[model samples]
Target: MNITISTFMKIAVTVIVISALLFSVGYQMVVDESNHYDSELDRYKNESLGR
Candidate 1:
């Protein structure tokens, strides 16, 4: 029983760590995409304004 519990705990911890890493990577990608979009928009706006 103790061995099983230990194995379960290890698996749970590994899953949690992997999940957290994936979430962070996904969030960073979203943020980078947003920033890129904003910059492109600004560039277009400046061109329209003849800046």
Candidate 2:
């Protein structure tokens, strides 16, 4: 099978776009989970100090 330059370029662009989207989604989820855990920890610390 002979692939032309235009087809190769299209495939490359598609791969790049998909990779960027997956990376962004994974990064956002990590940040959100970290923030949630941090807030929970702070709440626990405050409660312990009050007691």
Candidate 3:
């Protein structure tokens, strides 16, 4: 019923790895969306600014 140090370490490591992977995927998704939005905004800027 009680967890040992090794067991706790293993669970902690697993949780960390899973969290990092999920964060990486979510971060990249936001980055991609931002990049897309920037390009679109640039197009509008160029058309309006006559640059």
The TM-score leader among the candidates is: 1
Q: Mind sharing the TM-score for model 3?
A: 0.78
| 1-51 per-residue lDDT for model 2 (tens digits) | 356888999999999999999999999999999999999999999999994
| Candidate achieving higher TM-score, 2 or 3 | 2
Per-candidate TM vs. native?
0.96, 0.88, 0.78
RMSD of each candidate? 0.5, 2.4, 2.4
CA deviation > 4 Å runs, candidate 3? 1-3, 49-51
Q: What is the C-alpha lDDT of each candidate?
A: 1.00, 0.95, 0.96
TM-score: model 2 vs. ground truth:
0.88
Error of 3 at 19 (Å): 0.6
- For candidate 2, the lDDT comes to 0.95
Candidate number with greatest lDDT: 1
Better of 2 and 3 by lDDT: 3
lDDT of 1: 1.00
- Candidate 3 residues 17-46, lDDT tens each? 999999999999999999999999999999
Pairs that collide, model 1:
none
